[model samples]
Target: MHPLPQLESYAIRTFEIDCNQQLTIPALVRLMQETAMQQVLELNISVWDLEQYSLAWVLIRKRIEIERLPMLGEKISIHSYPTGADRVFTYRDFRVYDEAGQQIATAATTWLLMNLQTRQMSRIPAELLARFSGYFPPVEMALPYALDSLPPMEQAFTSRNYVVGWYDLDFLKHLNNVHFVKWMLEALPEETLAKQQIRRMDLLFLAEGNLHDRIDAQFQQIDEATYLHQLVRQEDKKVLATGRTIWV
Candidate 1:
């Protein structure tokens, strides 16, 4: 068997940066995910292949820690590989560095295999497990805790409704997970974004939102820089996603 490929390089585009000239959280999340997907596809188990097996990769939890967001016009090299699996959950680690070789961020994410037909969790296949059997580096940074479970705080904060736009849909025909992070950050107070930078962020996707779904977003300020947010469908009040952000 060929050794699994382990790293990829990406350019930091001007549109990917924020007003401060640093990479935005949504763009960073997209990069990490794209790198991982590319690595997996190169290993022969492409998304189309998984679909043929009636399987799909569903992201359950993700956490990222940033020492410093890379600036625009820089190149980033990302190193990533599957760490291991636990029953139905497969874990992966990503480490990013600037062109100068300075560490920028580290992230670890958990994914669950889903039975595409039934829409339920599925067990790991033997062949899939064997692919990651040998020699991979351990996660160097501390794995972050899962996002906290939060109660509805509607009375404390005003909620705003947003229409899922055509641009928000991905190949999956649903709102891309990174856009949930984007919406959560956009819902924050302007002063908060101006003064604080995200040190860590955790997100849990509970349900999928389709085009035309009305999403109600509500946020609560835990403190000056920490916040908890929730997004849900307005029709049935079904929860869509929850996120917790820590800023410094």
Candidate 2:
């Protein structure tokens, strides 16, 4: 269920810059999400209307590979398209560009339809999924383990957590991937954070998590800043997604 009409573009704002003077990774992602909202609104599927049915679309998982960060005062254009929609799942794709038209990042994301009251997975309404047709390239929802999986975590990587609250949820309802990464990055040390830059990142998903789930992000130092990151259940230590971000 891809929507085909136009590519959504965004303007940069002052507050969005990170300490390194580039747009914060989270803000870049927020812009990509903003573009999708514009597409949906152009299709006449207002956020207010979706709320009427006690339904919301939640980004289940996303992967972003950035080439270079954009600095302050630069304008951006983001093209967003639906990959396709499947029962209980919808795929979204994005390409971000800088003022000079060079590509900055490419991200593909998956979303799931959820019932507000029960907070359970539900099938995408046929009409809702069809709204995206003609707009997205042929895309498919990824199944677990097929993307890739990692081995079990070490014992040191257990019983940590960051709570789910109003601010943690993005426009998409699920926890933002950057927030997950931020927690993973910050949990280490400033020395590690300052010296190492992420060279490669691979993340795999196993389940959806939300409010009050008692989640903890775990890590093992490969060397310097490189690490194996795991998001786990606090009680059982069930693996949610295993990730690796290597530092250069």
Candidate 3:
């Protein structure tokens, strides 16, 4: 296995950019996810490799800080690597840069290994940790803040309902993580989306949503530019995820 981190280059495509010509948050996350998958595949520790052991990776938390959003047609580079692992969680980080080599964004993510059949969290395997020995010295990026202690959602300032669709499910048969961000933001007012850009976002996934599940996305204003968000399954009233976003 290579000890070096992976670096991939890409051009921001038209579909990846929003109406304002800036790359959307979900699009950036998709790029990061793809880059990480490519790296693991090259190292022979990808999801397919793990599935042989009845293990699968699940993203539990992620935090992103945006310096600037890349415009459509802009060339950018993403550097990704496994940071480290604990008893129950593994870490990865990403650095995004523009063509000029200026850092535009950075993200840190935490993942858990789950037993495919049991649907329970598993401890990090020593052999799996050894595969990333060469990629030591985790990048100095800000970790997801307050993920374990999200702000209370006393009252929802705005809310929306969504019925999980077929396309929303990922390979695990659960709603993809990125859609949670989209749903959370959908609960915000149009004026908030139009006037402000998200400077930072923190998300903590607590449970999974399945196809046809009714989800209530709710947002509570925390301050002038900060908000607390939650996605709850309507039938059970179970909170699937909690998040906070700071807008500028």
Candidate 4:
């Protein structure tokens, strides 16, 4: 395979920033997602490549840590690579840097191979594992690749309702993961969004949300700087995803 930790640079654009002129979480996710797609495509192991095997990648959980959010007009570089794989999951990591080359953010993500027909998790194919082996350095994140459950709502401090739009669905016909982050943030108090910067976030995607589903996004403050969030489908109250975020 090509050299590890492929790099891609982007100039933060007008549309990618929030009203405060800082890069938004969803935009950051899109940048990282594009960088990842480029890396897998270069390795001939992209979702299209796996489609021939009746499989596709599904992201299960992710954790992001930010030293600072890049501002509008800033140039940032994302360095990403596959970290390793186990029976059930393949791991990936990303480091984001600014024009001055200072690290601003890091993310660790867990992905599973899904059987296209059954929509069930699948074991990593030996050949596929072999393709990634030795190309990446030893894994740096902790093992078991799990996220902690968000504390029970106990009465959400704030809530908002949204109907999934056609544009929110991904190739799987399910809501794209980044929108979950967007909805969660939307449910937060306006004061928090205006005054604080996110220092870290952890998300666990529990279920798929289809188009036009009514979603209730709820947020609860656990402490001064930490908060818990949940997205539930209004029809059956099925939790589509949960998240925890810490702000500075």
List the candidates' TM-scores in order.
0.90, 0.75, 0.93, 0.93
Tens digits of per-residue lDDT for model 2 on 99-197? 889978877677777788897988877677656655655434322212345555565454357776767765656666666756665566556555555
lDDT of 2 at 114: 76
Q: Write the per-residue lDDT of candidate 4 for residues 92-166, one digit (tens) a residue.
A: 888899999999999889899999999899999888888776676754442334446556667675479999999
Candidate 1 per-residue C-alpha lDDT over 81-149 given as tens digits, one digit per residue, 9 for 90 to 100: 776677988877888999889888988788888887898999989887676645344445335434455
Tell me the tens digit of each residue's lDDT in model 3 across 110-180.
88899988999998788887777567563444344334567778986547999999999988889998899
Measure candidate 3: CA RMSD: 2.0
Clashing pairs in 4: none
Instruction: Please report the TM-score between candidate 1 and the true structure.
Output: 0.90
lDDT of each: 0.79, 0.67, 0.86, 0.87
lDDT of 1 at 132: 68
lDDT of 4: 0.87
* Evaluation by TM-score, superior candidate among 1 and 4: 4
Give the Cα error of residue 138 in candidate 1, in Å.
Answer: 4.3
Residue 40 in model 2: lDDT: 77
Ten residues in a row with the worst lDDT in model 4?
138-147
Spell out the clash pairs found in candidate 3: none
TM-score of 4: 0.93
**Candidate 2 residue 91 C-alpha distance from true site, Å:** 0.8
